[model samples]
Target: MIEVKQLTKRYGGTTAVKDLTFTVDPGQVTGFLGPNGSGKSTTLRMILGLHEPTSGTVTVEGRPFRSRPRGLRHVGSLLDAQEVHGGRSAVAHLSALARSNRIPRRRVDEVLERVGLAEVAGRRIGGFSLGMKQRLGIAAALLGDAPVLLFDEPLNGLDPEGVKWVRDLFRGLAAEGRTVFVSSHLMSEMEHTADQLIVIGRGELIAAESLEEFSARGTRQSVMVGTPDTEILRDLLAAEGAAVRADGRLLTVTGLSAARVGEIALVHRVPLHHLSTRSGSLEEAFMELTADSVQYLAGEPR
Candidate 1:
């Protein structure tokens, strides 16, 4: 497991991460979420020892990463997959990493095949497409078969099939009892993939919990009713404290359940064509939760 306790980082007058505390347990996929300039990459860098925290601590298995001489054997990561040398072949890159970390050379070939890069193993990275480069980066991460993995925007340039493939690949890794932590800005993609979510904004932790519990926090369940007697039903439901809004022949009623709304319509002798409870979508709920935390605001048209 990875533990972050009151971790904070500063660059001159600007603070990137602030007093953040969280834990990433094994055998699950934890998604780190935030918008642009929300300090996600900064936090990831601190965790990987690429940046020093101004205060507090982050540890993997009860110690700082730099304390381990064979760090790659404990944690595998793909941060900025495109930050590789374009002059080197995929095999050469992995081989170099393996040699430095004392990993077997055959492990390079195994990881290349595992990430579907064996066919292009000898090809220079400059000739690889964005998706292929991403695959090669993942192959390098898996070369050591480490117990923990971290990926940042792993689906950035992949097609739909490639996106799904990577999603399932992370899920499978977590099922094998590995610690998988991925970061993404896309909530819809995360909704389909992550079992747990850690959401932050402007360097502050907004939420950290299971996806179900996070989604459940936005359950402002409302009933949508369509009837010819819209005006009458709207007034009746309003009088019953149902927070009713009328749009054409439809009444959007909140602060009440579907059954209560139906009973009110029946008792009031109103005809109903449609009555359905609208549960909040995760995206909708997320917008509501982080509406204030959005750092970049587009201006209205002139």
Candidate 2:
């Protein structure tokens, strides 16, 4: 388990993380989410002892990570996949890390194969593609076989198959009761991978809760009704005080449940061609929650 208490970090006059308090429990995949410039990377660095907090504390298994001897054996992290010696072969890199950390050399081969890099284990880091580098980074992290793992943007350069493999890998690690924490700006990926979510914005805590709970904060449930009698259905729904809008053949109805909408249509002899309820998507909820926290905007707004 990992615990952070009132954790804060600063760089001169800038604050990267605020008084954030949260816990990452084992046996679950926790997704760390935020918009650009939200300090997700900085917080991960603090947890790994790479960045010292300006105030407060972060501890792994009840103690500071920096206080641990052979600390790499307690927690493994992949902060930057490219932060490796370009001249070293994958085997050479893992071997050196193992030797210095007192880890057995055999685990090096085991992890290389586990991450599907066994065929390229002897290849130089300089020639690897971005996806291959990510695999190598994951292999390095697994070399320690630590109980806690931290990954920032692990899927940045993965193909569809690689992405699926990574999603399964995270779930498998959590199944073994390890604390698996991943940070990414991709909500669609998180929707399928994470069991829990910790969202932040502008270096401050926005929410910390189960994925279900976080998605529950989305806009009220709305139903899409399609009918040949658009004109009649619209008038009837509006008469019931439900907000209704027409988009092509679909009538997007809000402020009423599916049953209510269907009942109203039937009462008026309206023929229904289609009807389905759509609670806002995870992406929708995330945007609604973090709209104000987004640090930048694209081209001119509509």
Candidate 3:
């Protein structure tokens, strides 16, 4: 597991992260979410010991990452897929990492094949597309077979198939009791992949909870009701303090449950064609929760 407690970082007069505390447990994929300039990259850097915290602590498996000699054996990370040398072949690049970490040379081939890069193992990275580079980066992360892995935007340039492959890979890794922490902007993907979430905004911790719990924080719950007596039901529901929006025979209601709507409709003898509850999505929850934390705002278009 990875533990961060009261972690803070400052560059000159600017504070990037402040008193951030969260634990990424094993046996599940934990998603790291934040808006742009929210210090997500900074926090990831600190966790990998690439940046020193001005105060507080972050540790993997009860110790700082820097304290580990062969770091890749314990923590593997892919901060930037584009940071690799473009002149080297995929195999040669991974081979160097394996040698530095005292990992077996054969492990390079295994990771390459696992990431679907074995066919292009001899190709120079400069010739690879962004998606292929992403695959190669994932291969490097898996080279050491580390217990803990951190990925920043691993799905940045992946196609639909590659995205699904990555999702399955992370799940498989978690099933093996490895700590999988992913940082990405794709809420739909996180909704399907992550078991838990660590949400931050403006360098401050907003939430660190299960995906369900975080999603429940959104206040946009509504019940969809289709009825011929829309006007009558709308009036009746309005009397009960429910906010209702109507489109012909359909009524979208907030501030009430589907069961309550059904009961009200039945008591009023209102004919109903359909009734269903619509819970807020992860993207909706993120937008509502992080509204104030957004650094750049675009004006509404004309």
- Ranking of all candidate structures by their TM-score, best first: 2, 3, 1
Instruction: In candidate 2, list every pair of residues with a backbone clash.
Output: none
Error of 1 at 75 (Å): 0.7
Residue-wise C-alpha lDDT for candidate 1, range 73-140, written one tens digit per residue: 98899998889999999999999999999999999989998888899999999999999989988988
Which ten contiguous residues of candidate 2 have the minimum total lDDT?
293-302
lDDT score, candidate 1, position 75:
89
Native-structure RMSD, model 3: 2.6
Per-prediction CA RMSD (Å): 3.2, 2.4, 2.6
Candidate 1 error regions (>4 Å): 224-256, 264-278, 300-302
Distance (Å) between predicted and true CA of 26, model 3? 1.1
lDDT of 3 by residue, 1-302 (tens): 99999999999999999999999999999999999999999999999999999999999999999999998899989999999999999999999999999999999999999999899999999999999999999998888899999999999899999999999999999999999999999999999999999999999999999999999986589999999999999999999999999998999999999999999999989999999999988999999999999987779553
In model 1, state the lDDT of residue 217: 94
Judged by whole-model lDDT over C-alpha atoms, candidate 1 comes out at 0.89
- Give the per-residue lDDT of model 2 (tens digit) for 1-302: 89999999999999989999999999999999999899899999899898999999999989999998897699988999999999999999999999988999999999999999999999999999999999999988888999999999999799999999999999999999999999987888999999999999989999999998888886578899999888889989998999999987799998999999999888888999999998776788889899898886788473
> Pick by lDDT: which candidate is best?
3
